[model samples]
Target: MNKKLLLICALISIAAAVGYYFSKGPERISVTQYKVAQGEVKASIANTRVGTVKACRRAYLAPAIGGNVAQLYVKEGDKVKSQQLLLKVWNDDLTAQLILHKAQIKANQATAKQFCEIAAGTERDSQRLSRLKKYDRIISEEQLDRAATKARADRAQCQAAQVAIEIARAKLEIVNTDIERTLVRAPFDGTVAEINAELGEYVTPSPPGIPTLPPIDLLDISCLYVSAPIDEVDAPQVKVGMSACVSLDAFAKKRCSGTVSRIAPYVLEKEKQARTVEVEVKLSDAKDLQELLPGYSADIEVLLASKEKALRVPTEAVLENNQVLLITADGVLEQRQFKPGLANWNFIEVLSGLKEGDALVLSVGREGVEPGAYVRVEE
Candidate 1:
């Protein structure tokens, strides 16, 4: 009877040990989580590739008539005003021609004065002879006729001299125009970005269909814009006057506000690139544009829609089928499907099936994180 009791107790002890081992439950997987909250969510699009920060007005300046650079009034980084002289090509011959024309005009004016005086004297003599012949018979008809003919001829000579003056003035204008063609002036208020020609350097006009470097590069930094390429699908949604934000690679922490100013009417088809349409965004903030420079690599985000106070979550936390994982009060992973509204690269709006203060699993890719699995949330 003692042996039987000991065996029964041993059997019960073994069974209890097995039950305890099986009841311990699955191990908890460590995970990171984000609590649901109310914040701003925006729907937007960005450039498909890198974009360029460009000036609103940029001019590649060169003299219309090629010649040796005579004077350089501006150097790189010099600020200039509209119509200010930036450079002058060699125009000594033109200037000399201008001076000659002026001198010729003066000479013609003097000649005109002398001829007119002679004409006036001849007319007076003709009148006197006419009166003498008619009344006193002191002057003969031949003398009167000769005096009248001399008067008419002198008047004609005087008119010809006056015409010569006008011709000289016209010639002077032509020389002045030629001189202007040899000069390079700023088309608008800007800073000189580059100067390819130096004093005494001979610069030539670009040949037709072949572009060459201009002698001067002028950029209006006061007004700036970003030119970026957007995918063809997104281009149709973009319109002029839409709000935008510009981020440059050089200024990582700064973002400038802008508005869409233009969109290309056609798409660009490149062999290696996706079909894209060019878009321009004008920077609206004067203070933010002070540090921006042309040629800086940039990116642009055009806002399409937004929700100011939407329940949102980090975009990375959302999983397949618009679902997100959350830890229940009992510490088990729960997959919940939600309706999403506005979404961007950073955040997504939660429309339904999620509430504020619910901690969503951010580390959805972590091992052992799935529906019904126990998780240990990281603080």
Candidate 2:
């Protein structure tokens, strides 16, 4: 009887050991967690591809009539005003022509004055002869007729001289137009970004239907904007005057605030690339405008809608079906379903089934992070 009782006791001890081992539970996982809080949530869209920082006004300048570059008034990085002379092609011939036209005009004016004086004297003589013939008959009819013919001829010569003066003036105007064609002027206030010709170098205007490098590149850095492309799916949500943020790859720390200024009327369909619509965002009053330049790589985020002081969760913390893995006070993972409102890449608005001050598992992809599993929140 004592041996049988001891055997029963041994089996009972083995059973208790097995139960203790089995009840120890699954292994605990260390995971990152985010505490729910009231914050701003935005519905925004970002560029699908890289965008560019562009000037509000950029101009590629070249002379209308090409010739040897006679003078370069501006160098790269020179600030210029509207109508400021930038360059002048070789125009010594045109200048000479202009001087000749001026001289011809002066000469024609002098000749016109001389001829008009002669015409005035001739008319007086003809009037005296006509009075003598009509009232006193002191001159022969043939002599009076000859006098009238001379007066008429003088008057016609005077008119011809005046027309000659006008012709000379018209020639002067033509010369001036040609001279302007050889000169390049700033179309707006900007900085000279490039100069393709030096003194005495031949520069040719671009032929029709063929593009060539411009002699000067002007950029209006005082006003700058960013042009980016968003996927066609997100294009409809963007509109003019919407607030936006611009980020330049060169200025990583700065996010220049801007607004939607324009949207392209058509979508771009590039081979092997997703269809995208071009959008332009203009800076309102950026203090860093001076530092930006055209052609700088940039990205933009257009805010479609925003909610302030809303129950928000890190977007990554939310899982499939609007669910999130919440960390219970006892360090156990609990799955909770919530209705979401506005969402963005950074945060999501929690419309229901959540509250401020709740802890959620941020690293939901970690092993053993399933609901009902024990968790150790990483400090």
Candidate 3:
């Protein structure tokens, strides 16, 4: 009886051990999977620093010769053409001076005409006197000499009067220029951004030792660009003519295409913490930019390289040594080496050893995620 009991206990212990062994089988790794796809793989660099939308040309306009603002032809937000008269300062005194100079020129011209007439008369008299002396020897030699002297004197007086007329004309031109200086004209085709002075208000120019407010602000928005700073380390990869995409905070939904127009030769030291280089990007489609204004905040993404229809996977799926863990047909992880092409922060291009429709492991550092380990895909 004791032997049978012992045998039953041994059988029960063996069955329990077998059941525990089967229940606690190999661990199954819970993993997320990615489906490889054929798409564009692009390597790009992005700047987090806020960029500025700048016009090709901007000006703070003020009168060259300052005085009370007499006329304002343009208001804020008015579009103007190059060389269009935009404003005028008080120039009554300058206008009066111009008129006075013109009258003086006219008077001088009249005097010149009178002097020329006198000269002609004196020359005729001199010729007549000389002819009489030669033919009849009646006129005295001294009288002929006096007539010739009078002719030369009158000619000199006429020349002097003509010179006076030229001087008066020059004075008139100077006054005309002064009057023109009192009028402010647009320097380029642009929109008026600001107007600081009202009619009858005094508008002064910027003095050498003092700062003054400008009467108007003009901005040429025909061509707009974004000035963004690139990290000095990434600056070497950036080149002029590279394609880029820009987004403005004001126009959040719209992204504008652009090309790299300029790259700074040297690094900028504006911030003490980081050294950066400025790059200017010109908008490819500037027509839509008309609605945008200068000084808007912008961001830029510069494309370094791109590949179309390439085999790509999420960047997190690629492990160190260019190895990727791909799920095999039996749902087991298999570590395979792949050749990498263009790679950015989010995705990487697989040059070889991968194809479309392949499944890849997406989880990072999960336990039981080694090679040959079975995985349960999370739906």
Go through the candidates in order and give the clash count of each: 0, 0, 0
Off by over 4 Å in 2: 1-16, 140-142, 328-332
- lDDT (tens digit, per residue) of candidate 3 on 1-379: 9999999999999999999988988668899999999888899887759999999999999988779999999899999999999999999998999889988989999999999999999999999998888788778989999999999999999999999999998888998889888999999999999899999998888999887778999999888899999999999999999998888888756554788999999998887879999998888775557577789998888999998888899998888988989999878999988899998878899888888888999995798787999998999
Residues 316-364 of candidate 2: C-alpha lDDT, one tens digit per residue? 9989999999899888999999999999999999989998899999999
Better of 1 and 3 by lDDT: 1
Clashing residue pairs in candidate 1 are none
lDDT order of candidates, best first? Answer: 1, 2, 3
TM-score of each: 0.88, 0.90, 0.85
Model 3 pairs whose backbones collide:
none
lDDT for each candidate structure: 0.91, 0.91, 0.89
Q: State which candidate, 1 or 3, has the greater TM-score.
A: 1
TM accuracy, model 3: 0.85
Per-residue alpha-carbon lDDT of candidate 1 for residues 241-293, written as tens digits (9 for 90 to 100): 99999888887665647899999989998745589999999888777787888
